[model samples]
Target: MRMRKILPACVLSCCLTGLMAPAAFADGCPDQEIAVETLKMKRAEDSEKAGKLKEAFNAAKTVAWECLGNDAGKRREALIKRVGRTLGDQEEKQGRLKEAFDWYLAAGLEADADRVMLKRANAKPDDTNAVGNAIDHFKRRNNEARVREMRGIAARNVDKWLTAEDKAFAARKDSREELGKARDWVYYAEAGSGKVTERAEKRGDTLATDDARRSIENAIAYYQFADKPQKAKGVRDKARKLGDEHARKGENKLAVEFYSLAGDDAKAAALEKKSEAEKQKTESARQDKFKKDQQSLEKELGL
Candidate 1:
C-alpha cells in the first residue's frame, strides 16, 4: 500500500488557512477598490462645486456602481440617491426634461418626476413633441395622478396658444395666412382638450368640458375670420360629420355643438333639447349614488 498519513494539526491548520487567504482578502475588498472609489467620489464633489455638473454626475454614478458591486450597496444607498438627484437637477437646468425625469425616477423620486414634467409641459406650449412624449411616459407608467396633472398643464398651455393666436389673428385679420394659423391653433387646442376629456371620461372625472367648449368657440371664430365662407366650408363639413357620428353614439351635447358650428340650426336645437334631458338623467344618477353612500355610512355608524 502507498504510505498515507494525516499531517500534523498545526501544519494542516496553516495549510487550510493559506488556502482561504485569497477568498478572505476578496471578501474584504482590495485596497485599490476602496481608494479608487473614494477618489471618484472626491472628483464628483469637486466637479459639482466647479459647476461641471455633468462630469460630477458621471463620476458619482461610477462610485455608485462600484459600491454596489463591492457589497457596500446598503451603506451607499444614500450616496446613490444623492447622486441621482443631483443628476436630475443638473439635467433639468440644462433643459433636458426627459433626462431629468429619468434621473428622478432612478432616484426613486416619483414626485420629482411629476414636478419636472409639469414644468416642462407648462414651458413648452409650442413644442408639441415634448408635451406628447411626457404624456406618453406618464401613461405608460400608469401614473394616473401625473397624467391628470399633465392634462391640466396641457389644457392651460392650449389656452395660452389659443390666446396668442387670437391676438395674432386680430392684428392681421385680413390675412388668409393668419386665418389659417388661427385655424391650426384652434384644431390643436381642441385636440388637446379631446385628449383630456377622453382620459377623464374613462375615469369618470367631470372636469375640463369648459376647455373643450372654449376650443370649439375659438374654432368657429377662426372660421369667421377666414377670407371667404368657402375657405371654412371644409371645416364646416367636417364638423357636421363629427356631429352626426356623436349623435349616433348618443353624445347629443357634442353633436349639438358641432351641428351649430356647421350652421344646421334645426338639428342643433333638436339635439340641445335631447342633451339637456340626458344631463338631467346623469345628475339624478350621481345623486342616487351619493345618497346610497350616505345611507351606508349612517348604517355603519348606527345613526
Candidate 2:
C-alpha cells in the first residue's frame, strides 16, 4: 500500500512539472510572449473599434510595451505605430488637435504632427499673435520651409481680416472691440512678420495709415461720449501724429478731421477754411470755362 501511494504521487508531481516547464524554464522571450502580446493588441484594436479612445490608448500602450521584447520581423512594432496613428486621427477628427499631436508624437508620426501644427497655428486665423507663436515653434524646430510658408499664409489671412475691419471701421469706427482687434493684428504683423505689415499698409494704398487716423478719431469720440476724458485725451494725443501724416500728404480734408479729433481745433478750423477756399477756386475756374464756351457759341450764332 505504501509503494502504490508513493508511485502515484511521484507520477502526479512529474506531470505538474511537465505542464509548467515551458513558462518556468524557457528563455527570456518565451513563445507564449508573442501570443500574449498578440492578444493584448487584439484588445487594443477592439477598444479602438468600439470608440473607447481612452481605453484604447491605454490598451495600445500595453501592446507597444510588449513589442519591445517579442516583436518579430518588426511586425508588432508596425502594428503599434499603426494603432497609435489611428488613435491620433480619431482625436484630430474630434478637433482635439493638442491631444492628437501628443499621440502622433508618441506614435512616431512626424508627418501627421506637422500637418496638425499648421492647422493648430491657424485655428485662430484672426489672431496674428497665435500664428506668430506657431512660426516661432517651427523656427525652433529648424523648419525654415514651413516657417516661410506659414508667414505667407499668415500675411494673407491678416490682410483679409484687416479688410473686413477697415469696412467695419468705416461704419462702426467707434467700436472699441473692432478697433482693438484690428490694432492687435496690425501690431503683431508689424512686430513679427514684415510680409504681413507690408500687405496691411500697402494693399489699400493707405489702408493702415487711413485706418489708424479713423480708428483714433472714433476712439476719442467713444471715450468722450462715455465721460472718459482722460482716455479721450490719450487718444487725441495719438491722433496728432496721424494728423501730421495726413497734413504732410496734402490730404487736407482728412487732416481737418484728424486734427479736430486730436483737440487741435485751431488747426482743424484753418484746414477747413483752406479747403473751402480751394473749393471756391475750383468752382470759379469751372464757371470761367463755362462762360468762355457760352461766349464762343453766342458769337458764332450772332446772338
What digit string (tens of lDDT, one per residue) describes model 1 on residues 1-303?
223344466678899898877532233567667667767777877877787866765676677444335444443455556767888988999999878988988767778987887788778855666666667777877987766665655556655654554465456432234334333443434445443223222221121122254444444454444333453565566677878998999878788888887788999998888778879999999999999999999999999
TM-score of 1: 0.40
Per-candidate TM equals 0.40, 0.41
- What RMSD does each model have against the real structure? 24.0, 16.1
The CA lDDT of each predicted structure is: 0.63, 0.66
Worst 10 residues of 2 by lDDT: 200-209
* CA error at residue 228 for candidate 1, angstroms: 22
- Candidate 2 wrong stretches, greater than 4 Å: 1-54, 62-76, 89-103, 119-137, 186-303
Model 1, residue 139: distance off in Å is 1.8
